[model samples]
Target: MEYHPEPVQQLILCCSCGIAIPPNPANMCENCIRNEVDITEGIPKQGTIHFCRNCGRYLQPPNYWLSCELESRELLALCVRKLRGLSKVRLIDAGFIWTEPHSRRIKVKLTIQKEVFANTILQQQFQVEFTVANQQCDDCDRVMAKNTWKAVVQVRQKVSHKRTFLYLEQLILKHRAFKNTTNIKEVRDGIDFYFAQRNHAIKMVEFFQAVVPVRSKSSERLISTDIRNNTSNYKFTYSVEIMPICREDLVCLPVKLARSLGNIHPLVLCHRVGNTVSILDPNTLDAAEIQSAAFWNNPFSPLMNSRELTEFYVLDVEPLGPTRGKLMLADVTVARASDLGTNDTTFLVRSHLGHLLNSGDHCLGYDLTTCNFNNDQFDQLDAGRIPDVVIVKKHYPGRRKKTKRRTWKLKTLTKEQDELVARKQDLKRIEQDYELFLRDLEEDPELRANINLYKADDARSVMTNGGTDMDETETDFPEVQLHELMNELDINDEPDEAMQ
Candidate 1:
């Protein structure tokens, strides 16, 4: 059997352009069909942009605010991304044209290029008008509403001091843990943090656990319920309690604890430095470091706070090393400003401040000898009389003044702002590195020749297209020779004596 070729049909004329073309659905040529089919069909004539007034951020769908400056390329990109036309065409370039000065409306000109057929490129330009709308973002809205929290974290310490809270506040700020909190309230001896989610409160509790010794307990209350959908919403609260004892607090240990600790001394001075808590025996000069679990199990009540400390005149001093000190007492009459008595008393001084004290220097310490004993000590018979004095810190005679407490506040940066700053720095560094690379390329004759070869090819193409001038300004990025770059890196990677 012989295969026969089909007869060819006559070409038909395009209805719109009156051009001869193959029969098709619209009976129109490619150019005529393209002209009739609007690429900007689904494109919006006007677009609405929601922005935050206070922070100057654009609303980026759902519940996020983007740090986009007004009339910036970033802002324009965001607006263009929201357009429906962006999804259909391959965007070549976009530019913004300002019509009225200080107006919220912006005219955006977009150039899109698409390949409708093989080796056939179609380029089109369209304008999109934008209108700015003022709307607060989710974060700002929550802050303004104030009652939108779903959880609360109550941080409390049993001690009657605010130093722990102050320290915790600094830690929170340093770690940026408080950024998740919606609001913070200062209480008498603690702080209350309101959060938009329960996980945020839990994360904060975990943060405290990592940094300090904390005990946490959680409770939840039913806020609302949808019986129809069998759904329930709850508000959670996490109670985090810190250890009672703080740094430089004079504490008396229980008899059982004293015996368990090898009968060092019932009179213990709490010294908290960083995450470690040390119980210093003023008499034996022995220090025992206790973990959080052990400290909580056998807690000691503070007999004297650091604020109740009084200044004592050092009549005589026996020099010890940086960690230890001994003192000799004389019958010198010293005026007692703490109202214990004005008498000549002889006592032994064992303190960490021994290295810092001189014969005439005054030190701030607690007079534990004056404390009254209770039944807890009498039962154990372990309430031995404490030392006459325990030096806590070196006190200057004329340096007595009210110490100001540090104020704690949360310092937070928006995610967009942080990203923007990082991007700017990265761009600057990239620019610097690129400039150096370009200079290096110019200095290297071989690399420069390779780049010129590429430029020559581009110039030939322009000339073939009947264009005389090769636009240098249009070529922002010069082609780099990859093999040359690799060779340069290999040469620099050689081991040197200085590196060794």
Candidate 2:
């Protein structure tokens, strides 16, 4: 209103750099003030990291936990990434000072460079502190808390044996298939795996499908619902049933099924030498594999098990032909253990222990004559009244005394024994594969060259005398560097196209 220009305002100079700037409380220019300001202003003095004591993993954000051998470095990186000051400054390098084991506090040295002014960059070093908090991750917490699973996988086989479950358990452990499983329970005929997520259960089912022939059915139940938040929680159950047959069992095939299977045999022996079940004609010594679909459509029932086996004494034996590896053909005259009379049955049978059998030797076999034949008319007609013996093992007379006959129950490996054997076999196979891989690496020219290129100078010198050094004659062409060698021949290179 006075229309008067204010008296000429006096300009002040920066006290530190002697630069003229607007008057302010500090009497410093914009550049000087900016340089003086700390870029870590909004950063927390003490950062907390959630650590899972159970699994020894550190929590990343949003319900994710990372597993690493160097937990401290991982935690430090995660905490540094969460700092708000990092957005304003350019980080050059950062390092953590060593702290005592189990220390709550961590110290980090950060070298940050910031462009406070045009064509002007300022670099500074500062120390930031972090606090480690021992807390359970979501998975570990769910595992610790009972009955907190989001999905349950019930692995079962309809057979009376747990052999398939045992094999599945070994596969799971060897491949770490159940890495996300929260709990495992050993049921009567199978196993139950509890997972924290439905996807994990699905992943497990997929693994089963890849390795074992399985059929799965899934169902879900509503746990809770939040109408306001539009969220619902559910618990899922996946029932995965494996094949109902195992190795070394006597199964009766229907007449129609036998005809479908190339009229092989009605009274077939189930021998699971590999993944598939090979139905063998005990009389003709012919075999045919039963596929998953065929087996599911017409599943064979076990007519007799190993426990129903009895001993027989060989009266006379004659080799019919040349041996076929461990199997051979022989005409064996044998009498049952209960019958020591001169009446002995002679059978032209395929025997695994034919070479070891001599006159008067005792052997164990399943008595097919006593098998119940109700609906299995084909077996009743084909194997009726004939004391055919499927030789299993050799027996000694010095063993324990025979016990009284009792009711027949299915024979199966106990849980402990089966698991132990499966684990051992899995480990043995892994070791053998590893050894074969090492041998191949040593023998493969490209792999050997690449390995030599990465070896330390001292190791190379030591290996030179043994003629195992990298091919130095190719130096004229090109001295293959480590990176080039890696690109050319990787140790984990896939199989050749022809092999695939």
Write candidate 1's Cα lDDT for 1-500 as tens digits.
99999999889998887978877766667777577666667779799988778667787776556775556878888888789767777888898887774687878898887666555556788888988889976556656655788998888877644555545654564456766667666655577888888888889888888877767889999989999999999999999878777777877777777777777676778755345567877555677766667767876567777657777777666644434324222222222344435566655655555445666666678775666655365345444464567777555443212111101112222211123324765556434434433433433344334222113223334446542333343232233433332211223232111110
Error of 1 at 147 (Å): 1.4
Per candidate, the number of residue pairs that clash is 0, 0
TM-score of each: 0.59, 0.55
Q: What is the alpha-carbon lDDT of model 1 when measured against the actual structure?
A: 0.62
Which runs of model 2 end up more than 4 angstroms from their true locations? 1-49, 55-103, 108-128, 224-233, 273-275, 311-328, 332-348, 352-364, 369-375, 384-387, 393-500
- RMSD for all candidates, in order, please: 20.8, 15.9
Taking the tens digit of each residue's C-alpha lDDT, what string does model 2 give over 1-500?
A: 67988798788888989977767766667667666876566656556666777877777776667665443576668868766668778889888877776677777888888765455566777787777678886555645753688899888877644445544554564465656777676565577878877899999988888777667899999989999999999999999887776656777777777788887767667755234567776445567887667767876667765546688888778777655445555767777888776555555455545667888788778876565555655445544524467876556554212111111111112122235335765556434434323333332334333222233334334434543332443222212233322222335332121110
What is model 1's C-alpha RMSD? 20.8
lDDT at position 207, candidate 1: 85
